[model samples]
Target: MNLLNCHQINELLSAYLENELDTTTTLTVANHLEKCLSCEKELKALTNVSNLVKTVIREADKTDLSLVARSNKINSLVKDEITSKIKATENLVLASSNDNSIKTSQNNIVKLNLRPKWSALSKKIFLSLAASVAIICLSLFTITYYATSTGPLLSGVARNHQFCSAIEISNIGWHKGYPKERLLQANNINLPKLDTLGVHFSDLHPCKVYKAPFLHMMYSKGDKQISLYYGSQEAVNKFQEKFKTITPNELYLHQESNLQIAAISTQKNNLWIVAGDLTKEEINAITSELAINSLSNTEESKLFH
Candidate 1:
């Protein structure tokens, strides 16, 4: 009988030791081990290692409480040293004031002088100003760190021209292209022939018109259904205008599949198209059929560009 490899034996040893393998797999391993001397030796070594680990853990859990007490005593000594230093600083300030003329005059007279009052008030103001500066510095540092860390991720999402929006669709099944004739019958929108559109039947779905500034669509390709949108109408329109001179063939060559095919004349061009995941050929077909009637004037284009 052929012996199991070291890796295979290790797998069986782990499962057998953990008691995780089901009856059939366990029995298979056991039968192989009975005929394989090399596997039996590996299993024995693994068992010995597991036993040693358990023994070590049990001993570690029984550590003496005196060690913990000593650690706490060390921490207390460090805190007491810090408190003593602060008290010493306060005492030094009080002692230096006793030798000054301001303190001598206050001791000689019962009435409070305006000079001493002003000095005390000024000290308090200075301390308050210092604290405020520290807080502002800390806040700015934290903001800068967060912005630096997250900037790249945000830039990537923006570059992809991808955004998401929620739409209220009453029927999800209809959008998935299910019960096809029934859905078309109810909506009174004829199912555009799949071959005529040059797209597979599975790749299309009916989507509802949501609030603008966001364009929402529900479509399915094979088993996957996706809802996609652009972030803002202004951003979309700006991008479309930037690429106005770009022809369908040229855009296809550049593989700029994220842009949608525009279907409006220049004057009434409110909706900007945003594309998602379509191949170059598919994008070319769509844009050829849906090109804008007029390109933006050179003067207007220059303003945005």
Candidate 2:
């Protein structure tokens, strides 16, 4: 096989590291990397990121929840730490690699010391699922964002996402049964009758999305799961105007990027926000069934349009 250039090898480096390439392609990359110093450096960068992810996972829920740090600033701090740690490994690698003149280059050997240096890993999220699982598994972590126009709404959404991600990364909230029961017991959150609504909840936790107390419920059906939030009337209305847009129904539906969101007036006209990998119809089904049952069950006054 011909020698693979930096660009070509770069294309396959991630897959090579993940052992996703076939025998022939794998050999081609390995053989090329054995001779190509530049591509090897690039591969090391990816590996460092992976190691940082491991650090994050090890320090899960250890993030110093500053009410002020923005996501980008947190990222810069994390990268600087990685770079500093990488520097500390340079002389160690140089001392050894220099002895073996055959394959030695200016680049340092990649180390896998995943000791938690920073208070938390950066909030950056890796997107490609095929090449790496570290970043994907760790999930994105962002400081509270309350400066936006829709402060409560956006803040609530982001907090909800963070809580759900934490639960997911903890190896809970995926399977049914005892896991959900344990979470429910641990969090002491309220659980509504959702089984009749065709949505089987797996985990329930008492979470506060930017000061709005919600009983966050996680439910899975097949390959997808969603986070459903139940909050008081004031807390729900802070996100948006309520009871003004319903037509022939009592629920308001919203969505974004495969995120199905819907809010309805519950028994006390409290808010119910449902969002996740669910479809639009699925969101409507859960909200409608819940709202109808809630009304019937509580004998609450209807203020629908």
Candidate 3:
């Protein structure tokens, strides 16, 4: 047969082997197979290959149990390894949590221990400041109280004796008047000739007119000038008693009208006998001088005489 003619016969043979051919085609293929030795050999070889494939499938089916067992073992091992890793992570987290809790507790304890000492130091500082403030306030109060009580008495003295002049006139002939000059001659007390000690008459005031050792003495000191009737020791004592509230260590001499007279001794023994209507200003000035102790006893006698 021609090769082209064998095309259909090959299809028939393939179909016949699978039992897909009709009865007529099966007989035709069988008849052709009996006559065609090449086709018959090809069919036999295809059959033998199919049988061998079936045998291999049967063997694979039989060994499937072994494969399933090995797969199950591998799955179990992976699960165990995963669980162990999870447990190890959980233990590490627990340990870290415990350490953090312990650290926080320690910090709290340290703060608590320091709190009392800090509080005590704060209290001590506050109390010390309070005490210092209290002491300063008390001292200021005492000073103010004393100044208020004493200020008025000093002011009153200044107001009463506001008209006197502050000048010193000693052993001057013109101050004695003409008739008093005759009395000075009779007493045998030689009087100095009248001359200004560059001191003005306005600077002189009649503080006191004295007899015996000194007579008709009109004393004048700064801002105060007055004429006094200085008769006897009895008169001076009567004046002192009337002004009994005068300050101690203050030398009281005489008074003319409302004016009061006092003398203080300096270091030079000089007497600063101030007579004033403004007694406070005068006394303040005198006290300032006294602080330095400059007016001594010798200076006191020269001013007094």
TM-score of each: 0.23, 0.34, 0.21
Q: Compared to the true structure, candidate 2 yields what TM-score? A: 0.34
lDDT of 2 by residue, 1-305 (tens): 46667798899988988899999999999888888888889899999998899899868746656524677798999999999987877766666553433343368435543334442433233234433675544342222223222223344533435432222212232322335555545433346566775668765654554455566777766656667776676555544443355432233344322344555555555666676656657766776666655535433334333
Candidate 3: lDDT over CA atoms?
0.46
Best by TM-score: 2
Worst 10 residues of 2 by lDDT: 141-150
Tens-digit lDDT string for candidate 3 (111-147)? 1121344788899999999999999888655543332
- Candidate achieving higher lDDT, 2 or 3: 2
The local distance difference test score of each candidate is 0.47, 0.58, 0.46
Worst 10 residues of 1 by lDDT: 296-305
TM-score ranking, best first: 2, 1, 3
Candidate 1 or 2, higher lDDT?
2
83-107: candidate 1 lDDT, tens digit per residue: 9987785566566555443333445
| Number of the predicted model whose lDDT against the real structure is largest | 2
User: Which of the predicted structures, 1 or 3, would earn the higher lDDT when compared with the native?
Assistant: 1
Candidate 1, residue 37: Cα displacement in angstroms equals 99
Flag regions of model 2 displaced more than 4 Å. Answer: 1-190, 196-198, 241-258, 279-281, 288-305
